[model samples]
Target: MRALVLDRPGSFRVAEVPDPVPEADQIVVQVECCGICGTDLHILAGEFPPTPYPITPGHEFAGIVAARGADVRPDLPVGARVAVDPSLYCGYCRRCRAGRDNLCENWAAIGDTVNGAFAEFVAVPAVNAYRLPDQFDGQLGAMVEPLACAVHGIRRLGLLGPVSAEPTVVIGAGTMGLLMLQLLLHAGAGPVAVVDRVRYRLEVARKLGAAQAVTDASALGDVRFAVAVDATGVPEAVETAIGLLDRGGRMLVFGVTPAEAAIRVSPFRVYNDEITITGSMAILRSFGEAVDLLSGGAVDPRPLLSEPLPLEGYGDAVDRIRAGQGIKWHIRPI
Candidate 1:
């Protein structure tokens, strides 16, 4: 089998590798499509500590079951179409016992702590694979992971409805930001505004449901927002979101900043204005919800994709994403 292996920081090679066989309670999946995420770039740049080297680096993947290991359930048959859950949590952990598996003390993400799906085949624990409906293709299935993250954010913020038509702001206009903007609109948010320095991304944001898209905050005028989402990992975006929130407004930080990145704000502002600052991490119970939402045709990610590239072009795909050249890029592993 051929794969794009990240042997070390800033180095990736496309080479032939041995195919994996599943262990007990595991399955071997023939990967069809995998979406390149920002975290993949983080790993490449050495932002996060490298997991085991020479690992196939991709988590947002969907494929068909090539084989099932011993003790596998007959219901989840071989040849079943599936999308990966990616998160691995020990059921015996304190967090898992409390029903917060996303906060498991021994949590390990599939593509990070273990080998991932950027290959012709991957071995995944049966618990981490969810059967997808026949109507869902690998291309659309690849989006389930990222969309689940957005769904988790929305739930964590406890975004109250009767979400006013008054201006709502979203900063970043990147992939997550664009998705959140669309979701908010679908949920009845009005006059939604998106801010970003990139003109092209702002244009894409507008098409995705942003009522107003601007390269500079000056264009937002004196209008205050009832809700704000900071989808850029940049600290500047967080600070700007804090300043833009109306009294009693809530702001959700949906982006993952660098470990060293810090944002300093006035405690008096948060206290006096009753502002709420919430941070969302990985998806919890929303993976299934995201899949259902996509399958139900409630949210369309097709317009969000700028291009799809084959596995051989993985490096170029990464470059395009790093350069802000596309909304999202899917890799065809087959």
Candidate 2:
């Protein structure tokens, strides 16, 4: 099997490696499509502390079951197509006991903490795999992971809270931001305003049902929103989105900001306006819901899909993502 081996930080190579053999409760998946995300870039740059060297980095992926361990469930036989939840939580952690596994004390994830699906074959826990419809190709299946994160983020935003038709603002038009935008609409959260520096992304956001799309939040000019989401992961953007919230407004910080990043906010205003600020980490129990949404066409994947490259072109894919050239780029390992 050939895999992208990150020899160390800032160095990697596509090299032949031994095929993964599943444990008694695991399954081996023949890689099909794996999406490149910002986290992968962080791992490559040595910015993500949890990642160990000489590993493969690709968490958002889907593929066909190539082999199963002796104890694997009969329902997940070979040839079954599936999307994997990369989260690796310590079941005994305090947070896990409290039903907040995303914040488990020993937080880890496939691709980030172990060899992941950026290869021809990867082994994963059978319980982490969610079956995909036979008609769904690996490309569409790969979207389930990211969509699951969006679902969890929305849940954190109080999706079932008192319905207010007031508009919501989503800062950033990247894959995650767009996913959040669509979910907000699907949940009837009212007209959504999308903000991105790129004009083309804003156009795509509009095509995907954004009531307002602009290069900057200031363009909306004095019109505050009842809800504001920061998906850019930039301190300035997060600060600006927080400022755009109307009195009594709520904010969800869904993006992964740098550890050293800091934002400025008016403490007095937060107290007087009774503002609410919250954050959602990675996927929780939302994977199944995301699969349902995608399968039912509630969230369209076509607009976000971009041309995929072969596994050998991983470096080019990274460059494309860094350049913000497309919505989502994937690696076709098979």
Candidate 3:
């Protein structure tokens, strides 16, 4: 099998590697499509501490079961179409026991800590595979992972309705930002606004139900939001989003910002206004719900997807994402 193997932080190659064989509880999946995520960028830059060297970094993916281990479930047979949950949680971890597995102490993931789907084939635990409907093709199935993250973010955000609809601003119009916007709208968050420097992305956000899509947060004028979401993972953007919240507003940091980055906040404002600020990590127990939403047509990501690049185009995909040239870039390894 061929894969994009990163020998170190600043380098990678499309080279031949041994095909992954299933473990006793795992299955070998023929990867169809794997979306490049911000985490991937972090791993590529050595900024993500959990990642190890000489690894394949891609977790947002879906594929067909090509082979299965002997103990695999009957329902998850070979040749089945599936979208995998890359989360590797320790069942006995304290956090897992408390139903907060996303914060598990021994947390690891397929692409983050192990070899992942930036290849022709990857082995994943059978239990992590969710059968996709026949209607979900490669790209749509690949969308389940990111949507799952967004779903988990919303869950972390808690109850959103406040008697009536109010403005919910989503900062950044990238893939995650746009997905967050859709979820906020479906949660009955009224007249959601979107902010991004990319005009095309704002246009897409408008098409996806953003009441107002602006190129900059300042362009939004003095308008304030009952809820504000930062999805760019840029510290400056996060600060700007925090500033957009109205009195008693809730802020959800949905983006993966720098671990060491700090932002200025008015302690008096938080105390006086009763403001609540929270941060959402990756997928928790939300993978199934994301698949359900996509299958039911409740969340549409087709507009955010662009033509996928081949395995060899991995570097180009990274550059495109860093340059903000596209929304979601997928690597079709096969």
- How displaced is residue 57 in candidate 1, in Å? 0.8
TM-score of each: 0.95, 0.98, 0.97
Q: Encode model 1's per-residue lDDT on 186-303: one tens digit a residue.
A: 6677689999988888878877778899987778989888888999888988898888888888889888888888888888988998998998888798889888878887677877
lDDT of 2 by residue, 141-182 (tens): 999999999999999988833465788999999999999988
Clashing pairs in 3: none
Backbone clashes counted, model 2:
0
The candidate maximizing TM-score is: 2
For candidate 1, the C-alpha RMSD (Å) to the true structure equals 1.7
Query: Which structure is stronger by lDDT: 1 or 3?
Result: 3
| Candidate 1 local Cα displacement, residue 37, angstroms | 1.0
Flag regions of model 1 displaced more than 4 Å.
160-166
For candidate 3, give the lDDT of residue 312.
93
